[model samples]
Target chain A: GAGVSQSPRYKVAKRGQDVALRCDPISGHVSLFWYQQALGQGPEFLTYFQNEAQLDKSGLPSDRFFAERPEGSVSTLKIQRTQQEDSAVYLCASSLNSYNEQFFGPGTRLTVL
Target chain B: AQSVSQHNHHVILSEAASLELGCNYSYGGTVNLFWYVQYPGQHLQLLLKYFSGDPLVKGIKGFEAEFIKSKFSFNLRKPSVQWSDTAEYFCAVVSGTYKYIFGTGTRLKVLA
Candidate 1:
């Protein structure tokens, strides 16, 4: 079975640019999560979605960060006006349910210059 | 605020040596604990988890973790680590909330 997967393994963008990272969760997964991992740091939860409903977005750092999971399958994390501070790896994970073990993706590394 | 702590930042050991990594969390309630491993160039994968029942839980690759509620700790252990075990290990805790609070992670280098 295919695990969670993220597209554009690497991305480079200038400051003030907008970037979108996509995630494809495993088939039949009902829960999806987004996290940000800075250099030498653990992943920090950014948002969570149950099916097509966004359950939590409190972890998003600022208004520039947005995420959506329509159709209950694919999810996207978009950062507007990219900043140097936003340079980090974006990880996506999915689980059968909220309590089940999550399967992680390879992550998309974004660099803002 | 819920947070997880991994005291060891890095560890180096020889193959077949015993390994133990410390993980502690600050949350005042029932919690679920998990250990995840990320091999170089690979995605993070689950090593084990502790939800309830026995405090000692065994995971894949001869790994195990002990959840001690009194200490607010869940330490991962392996009696004999292999060279292939070199990877970054993360400890995460889920409290009443559904999101996971992860530790900074410990990078282990196993010498063959």
Candidate 2:
């Protein structure tokens, strides 16, 4: 794809339900990232992947948050026992290198009730 | 701990008005600074970035930013704003361990 793409543009889940967000990064991009954007706030880093390796996940807020880039091109972010506070826009970004320009996806807006 | 700070949460300006958005980060090291804009219902687009060389960086859509290392600041400026410029702007810095930290963001509303 020319740009990064995410699935389920919007998701509404009941509290305690588990939800998964997917991301398809640009072709052959070596670095991928996930971020959480609260309403009226900037995106916060959640995780990073260098190819298939999950190198950095220090920003994941809790155990409920888990992200994987199994094939090194597509990634999934799964949140277990979703809480009201988990309601936010989940963004995915990809870059050719670790500290270069990042191409972003439209993001998935999750609403937990 | 390193963090990015955006001075304004929301700003309103008339078309043709000059604009300036302030951004600051707390880190004393070599870093890469960037400015991104998100228009309504759109993904983030890079406005400009400063890795090295000149401190003043020019971006698309007549936008520019200045990187002041002493103040740890990268402020975005435009001589004249258009109604189309209304969007949310983000300031980010990539420092140690290749982590990208972002400010809270500034929402700009340009009224015609």
Candidate 3:
């Protein structure tokens, strides 16, 4: 079975630009999560969705960060007005349910100049 | 303000050496603990988890973790590590919710 997957494995953007990272969770997964991992750091929670419903956005660092999962399977993390501080790996994970083990994707590395 | 702590940032050991990594969380209630490993160029994968029933749980590749509720610690250990085990290990904890709090992670380098 295919695990969680993220697109645009690598992206480079200038400051003030907007970037979107996409994630495709495994089929039948009901929970999705996004995290940010800085250099030499562990992943930090960004947001979480349960079957198209955004339950938690408190982990989002700033107002420029936004996420959505309209169809319940595909989710997107969009960062507006990118900043050098936003240069990190965006990781996506999904689970069969909220309490199940999460499967992580090969994160999309975003480099903001 | 739930947070996790990994005391060891980096570890180096020769093959067949015993390995132990420390992890602690700052949550008081019941919690779930997990250990994840990321090989070079690979995505993070679950190594083991401690949910209930047992304080000690075994995982893939001869890995295991012991959860001590009173101490607020879940430490990973391996009897004899292989060279292929060189990777970054992350310890995460979930308390009362699905959101996981991860530690800074420990990078392990095993020499053959």
For this target, which candidate reaches the highest DockQ against the unseen true structure?
3
| Ten-residue region with minimum lDDT total, candidate 2 chain A | A95-104
Task: Tell me the spans in candidate 1 whose CA falls farther than 4 Å from its real position.
Answer: none
* 1 versus 3: better DockQ goes to: 3
Clashing pairs in 2: none
Report the Cα lDDT for residue A91, model 3.
99
lDDT of 3 by residue, A1-113 (tens): 58889999999999999999999999999999999999999999999999999999999999999999999989999999999999999999999999998999999999999
Candidate 3 whole-model C-alpha lDDT, 0 to 1: 0.97
Candidate 1 lands at a TM-score of 0.98
- In candidate 3, which residue ranges exceed 4 Å CA deviation? none
Better of 1 and 2 by TM-score: 1
Interface RMSD of each: 0.6, 1.1, 0.5
- At residue A34, candidate 3 shows an lDDT of 99
TM-score of each model, in listed order: 0.98, 0.97, 0.98
What candidate 2 gets wrong by more than 4 Å, as runs, is none
Candidate 3: tens digits of C-alpha lDDT, residues B1-112:
9999999999999999999999999999999999999999999999999999989999999999999989999999999999999999999999989999999999999999
